[model samples]
Target: MSNESSVAAEQGTAPAAGASHNHNPSPNHTVSKDTRRRVVTASFIGNFVEWFDYAVYGYLAGVISTVFFPESDRQTALLATFGVFAISFFVRPLGGFIWGHIGDRLGRKQALSLSIVLMSVATFCIALIPGYATIGVMAPILLLLVRVVQGFSAAGEYAGASAFLVEYATANRRGLYAAVVPASTAAGLLLGSLLAALLSSVLTAEQLNEWGWRLPFLLAAPMGLIGRYIRTKLEDTPAFRELAEKDDGVKAPALAMFRTYRKQLIIATGAVLLNAVGFYVILSYMPTYLSEELGFGATESFLATTIALASYIGFIFLTGIASDKFGRKRMLITASVLFILLTVPAFMLLDTRNFLVIVLVQILLGGMLTLNDGTLPSFLAELFPTKVRYTGFAVSFNLSNALFGGTAPFMATLLIGMTASKLAPGWYLVAAAVVSLIAVLFAAETSKKPLLQD
Candidate 1:
């Protein structure tokens, strides 16, 4: 092949002889359809398990506060619970560096397998910790410690899974494949919301605080085992394997990312701001917001969120497909613009406190979010070359998430208290959207191009 042909082949405009449509430029490394199916499954499950644990924690934050903290003041206890939640995220940036090294240098499979086990173990441990009555000050302390482990483990899951799927995907359908990450995440949240609703309705407050909250967490053990087994059985992604074969993989991926790709790192971190805030605020924290802040019934709040999450899962696949057709930058920009124009109105609708209207508004917010969330994994994956893809994605993603995303719920509550306004979270989301819009404007479109392999 001539130099132009080689470049064209790499860009997917032309193919090297015998290179499968489902594979990249490396003809010898064609990924079979069966393998692709399995890759999707393996990539989806670990993220599912990781987010399920997080969803359960967020949904049960109220019960956990009462169980782990002294109930001298309701607001104080709830703030303490969310404080532990936010503090745990501070460990994620460090985890990003560690897992990025493993994924970029060693293998994506290794980092994913290890992270899932640690996440599940820490989550399962949360179920066994004694309440404040039995453990005194140790209860909250242990809760925070376990949450930190969970946060650290979860740091690697999203970036590794996104990289694994995108590398294995056909160039034309990478967006759809990458959307599986957010879909699985929403699935986990849906299950958590349903369980929360069920327990809150069927069990008395005493029962929920004493024992019911622990039940969902115990499922993490078997789920982790299964996620690990599936991930271990798979080989590394074709991109990683190709890099390894060429001996071109980076040795110090995190360092290289900072030194070589500072602009991409900055853009990626900024672009993630909206996802970090919107995800936590819309999907994870909304139930707490509705029930606690709006004085809605817990069961009703969970029901509304459950309905929204279900719609979100469906909307995600469509957004993924759309990104493949329309381009990621357009879809992302659309999401940001929509959030800026409509978030305050959405929150205004929620303040009316009507059950049906709240459900509609939540669904609307979730659908708008799909435009951003569904496209983000692929966009982030495309930002860096194969040499440091995992590191770049993880570090930038976790940095934004740690600083903004993890703190969103706490910030929302604090803002509401300080401003004496019910619309505080809405304003926060708008600001996040503006930041992301500016970042995405700076990004180059990667949908029509092939994966970068350096």
Candidate 2:
């Protein structure tokens, strides 16, 4: 016990035996496989539910446009829907700074617990809001208000969860464990897509616009309740606890990040662009892409996206294990290179309208997305010291997601409209991959390092 603290001192506040909680210390130090699995599952649930709420909105955008913007022209309504979607992302940086400060200054557990509560309430409220038929202009305004809550909370969820998971993990297995976050994200999206597909199949188009779109949003309540319980019952992560025990945490982490860790912050943000745009566009935005520009029909697109996302969840785990062995830079750089080489061909193949080909194309992009995303959270966590770890991860990751990821679908729709070419979106994806590729190539390999050693 004393020796453990001494070792922590030697390593500059290494993970303590556990926090000051009354629970068994077995879960804290020398983490048994069962302990690891249980802790990972707890942190993983909140992230899963958060992404589910987010994806349900993106997946139901077609119905949402009809319900919320009935008076607008088709394109205009669609634009407005996606525009609101983007607004949610735009507000995330504010959430990041607020939650990041709490995480760094207070504790990871506080930030993690509060975020799920906000997400649950906001997401459930979206289902209850009246459509344009009932409230006219107020419908879109109310929807926008709910989405704003969603964005604000989401900025805290993933970044905080990532820090939580990585901190709770055994040093060597950090990548494997952290991959669960992104995997959960895929699982959530897959669930949303499956639900959307089922609703589209069973319900009449009129029924779907009227009520079917509300079902997935309604599920948010139960899922969020479960997620919040899992997180609240668990203790805070060992990394944050060690910092707290030593009184080593920063006061204004967001500002300290700007003054001291600007270079790493910029690099991490650049690397995050690959994940933000690459994952969001391919999964969250693809169904709309398929239904509108590709003519796949709603059911076909939803089902295809579900299958692809299911595959993505599997690939994310595999890629995470590979990154631990092969190094993150190799996987990240390779992902970008492959994106540049294969994007146009993939888009061209997608234009075929064959369900089998479409599914395969989506699976390809999903695997490509996993290559970077599976490794990113842990990678970003390792890039900064504990004092500013949460702030650095939150700011860099959420800012990139806000600016690049949030705008991806809207940009894709705009690119296609402006150029009248399906290939334009692919080119955009390639461009995002390239920026991340250059950043990864210049960055040093970090797989073998200790947590937050930088």
Candidate 3:
């Protein structure tokens, strides 16, 4: 079927025979059983590919440091590698705004497809680019350019996918379906970490630095192709379709969000701080911490993080199921409180020399982080009406992530350097978690609310 027919079919029958808007009982209209399942699966897979492409950078940063800045000092080379990481984040808000508009106005399916394609091309380019030895400064400059493209593409991947899944699901299953986004992310991180570890183990350090590092980035092309195919088969969410039919879809969703949903924008931004900060701390930075701070080799650090992340994937789905059973607010509250209390202790324990203690700390920390990660997508998505849900979610999520999440490792390193103390970054995590807890208290409980009812 054509895209227009698919969108029309997704909108369902509008309010049957002149029924009043208030009288329409189905808040998101109605979705076919098959459409609903396809949307969820497609959302998960698209997000998976996006994250896998983005995260391979961090997992392979050491090799990237060598390739991109071959003659630079060790610190300078590492800084250049992370500079590319931060550069990607800087463009996320633009990605959020542009793609969020498409999601809100045109359709979520289109936005999802667009993001995957952009990310796939960017990742493939990174894999194929010549090194500093061959191309001088142009190599690193080109790498930076591709990273910007990645950041822009990834900006919409999570928020758009979550909003699509939540809008397509019944109210009772929103949390469970929304959790799929983060589950896919956790799965992606796990996959990337495992690939990095396996490659590092099988290949000598010289071989990995020389050429094996490109393999994971090249692999992203196929995953992106699979994601595009899955998303192509999926239908737009019922809520988005309904809004388009009513002429309620805003032409500029980002502007509508700032004008109409400003309060929600603030609250959602604040609520996501814990998710952004906590996730980056546990997933992206942990390997760095293990390798640099704890003096573990790269292979051991990867194994620990990979194991912890595998466990994190399980908790993500479990927390989502719990949110549906208990409520989103309660799960978030419990998570925030635990995170605030445990942040300092977890990091301190991780710093200890005992591997067993470090393993235990990782499990506890991963579980606490999962509490917010698993629920925030639905919690944030539910805060706004259909007309600006994507805008509200994408802008808030990406802005906070760019400002806080993307800078986490660099900030942590800076703080530790300045203080001569390893525990300083934990304070940052605790403080952010506290702010998130306060925001969660102010936001309304959305676990049982219908997607379009707000």
lDDT of predicted model 2: 0.84
Provide C-alpha RMSD values for all models, in order: 3.9, 4.8, 6.0
Instruction: Give each model's whole-structure lDDT.
Output: 0.91, 0.84, 0.82
Model 3 per-residue lDDT tens digits across residues 1-454: 4332222223221222332222122456667887787777788888999999999898888788898887766656666687778878989988889988888888998999999999999999999999999999999999999999999999999999999888877778888899999999988999999999999889998899789999999988899999999899876776766666777566777876776567778878888998888887789878777887678888888888898999999998899899998888898889889988988988888888677787778888899988999999988887776777888899999999998888877777677768888888788899889989998887766666455422
Please estimate how well model 1 matches the true structure, expressed as its whole-model Cα lDDT: 0.91
**Could you give me the TM-score of model 3 versus the true structure?**
0.92
Runs of candidate 3 exceeding 4 Å displacement: 1-29, 70-73
Look at candidate 1 and tell me the lDDT of residue 45.
Answer: 85
List ranges where model 2 is wrong by over 4 Å. 1-30
Clashes of each: 0, 0, 0
Order of models, best TM-score first:
1, 2, 3
- Compared with the true structure, what per-residue lDDT tens digits does model 1 show for residues 1-454? 6443443343334433553222254787888999999999888888998899877999999899899998678778888999999999999999999999999999999999999999999999999999999989999999999999999998999999999999989888999999999999999999999999999999999899899999999999999999899999998888888888878676789877777678788889999999999999999999999999999999999999999999999999999999999999999999999999999999999999999999999999999999999999999998887888999999999999999999998999999989999899999999999999999998878886767665
lDDT of 1 at 237: 87
TM-score per candidate, chains pooled: 0.95, 0.93, 0.92
Superposed Cα RMSD, model 3: 6.0
